[model samples]
Target: MTGRRRWTTDEILGTAAELLRTSDAESFSVRKLAAALGTDSSSLYRHFRNKTELLRAVADRTLEAAMDGYRPPDGWKERLTATALRLREAFGQHPQVAAIWGRYGSGGPGSRLVMEEVLQALRASGLPDEEIPARYHRVVILVTALIASEAGVGALLPEEYEQGMEQFRVAVLGADPDRFPALSHFAREIRPLGVDRRAAFDEIIAAHLAQIEIAIP
Candidate 1:
């Protein structure tokens, strides 16, 4: 009988992160991870209680990478936007990871560290103390939604996605221009564009920052 290979916690976590980068949660399984590692499926339980816990570990590692080399910005709005952009880039690298972490604000060490940075920036800003919590909540919700949207679309490769857009255009492009002028005009501009998650993220961040400005008291 063959013996099971010993795996280090760090190695397990690293592999889990890679698995998330290449695979979505829908198809990623502990058995698949074990196969990838050339180990028994049950052995992963030594490092993680279950799939959720393992993926949470992966998400936490991603947070560290996301904020790596990060420095405090000159002003609070700059701070928020800078952090937001880094997080978006991180998601771009591992789109599936976004959905996992977004569902749970479970506050692993890396998550707590990032949140502290945000709070530090908010404190330095002149926004009223009473309004800080609500503002923070809104920022979290908006950023998470944007990341999730990006991740969902990323289930396919870029060329595969572009093909999907072409197929959709074929389905709907036959609409009479006079009857649906708005759809005809806008579909041409937007459909080929596909999911510009970063652009959508920037627009909402600007709107939210505007709200932050109004909250200053």
Candidate 2:
């Protein structure tokens, strides 16, 4: 963390990412990140003009790691699903890193590469030149929305939810059965929103793929 170590741009960004995650991105600042790095704000400012630029760098790093060694599945449906799952796996680690979305200005090389893969997959699936753009938009929205929402939630949630779920169910069950019959009946089912996330992801990906099927015929 000492400047005597001569921090590299990548090293600074990686540290900044950890700091952002630790603070939940709500109150992150360059000064805070510099403190975490054991350096002064001016040093960080030299590499990144401001927090926004630094965050963009962190987001790009996450994006790059996610897609670096990825190999798409054989089928278009599988390839798209694989990509989404892979992205979620990486993005989930630095959940707060998502603060850079859209406001970060069209993303860096890593995001562009990810988008290219999606476009190529759609085209390879025999989607018409005209339909490819629309499909790309839909697919990107689906993937980004899923990852961003889940990662944001995961960042705020505690490591354990079992006890929380039980508490929630108990509270719901306290309601009068007759007046709140439906709520009482489904209390156990709605215990916790958490479940097999991979299955949930697959189901969402499948639904999107089904819609894209129309483009094939």
Candidate 3:
């Protein structure tokens, strides 16, 4: 007789996650996933009753991968920045998974754990218990907003966009010196600094967290 195969839940979720990472969520199917795993669709159904449940599983796994083993730093600001940056990196690495994460409710176990960590961090910083929820929400908003912005959606422009910026630079510097003294003086520095995008993101997150600390008290 043929031996029965055994598959752990992590194995199933990991396989689905790998597929989702490479392909769009819309194109992923249980039959295809099962085939990829050397099993049949029935086996997948046994693990996940429906596609929605499967997606939740996928999201849970993805978030766990994103947050697992992250240790907060000594300073609250640094810790907040680290958390935000890590979250951004995770989402950016798996754009498809990030899209799914943004849609789901944060009531999932992984999501709750993340919130707990944030609250604990804030409380450690001397925030009152009553204010921890609001503070946590602000941090979540900041991180999520930065993640959405960093997704690079609608930010890239055609070659003409670059040409337009150049033209604007020229027009400003070419104007009468009296009209735009600052532009004339710093025309060279006015050009894009070509800063590393990831570093710039970290700076922005750090700045935002600093601001939050001031407002929290």
Encode model 1's per-residue lDDT on 1-217: one tens digit a residue. Answer: 9777799977887887788777777788999889889998788897889988888888888788888899987999889999889988887788788888887544677788788888888877898788878888888788888877777777578888878877888756766778988777776565443456567778889888988888787
Which has the better TM-score: candidate 2, or candidate 3? 2
Error of 2 at 75 (Å): 1.6
Per-residue alpha-carbon lDDT of candidate 2 for residues 1-217, written as tens digits (9 for 90 to 100): 6335568998998888888677755588888888787878897888888777788888888888889988877988778877887788888787788645534633778888789889888987998798889889988887777777676556665744556666676778777898999988887666355556667878988988988897586
Ranking by lDDT: 1, 2, 3
C-alpha lDDT values of all predictions: 0.81, 0.77, 0.71
Per-residue error for 83 in candidate 1, Å, reads 0.6
Error of 2 at 168 (Å): 2.9
**RMSD in order of candidates:** 2.5, 3.0, 5.7
Stretches > 4 Å off in candidate 1 = 1-5, 191-196
Indicate the residue-level lDDT of 137 in model 3.
Answer: 82
Model 2 regions lying over 4 Å from their true place: 1-5, 99-106, 157-167, 177-179
lDDT at 196, model 1 = 60
TM-score-best of 1 and 2: 1
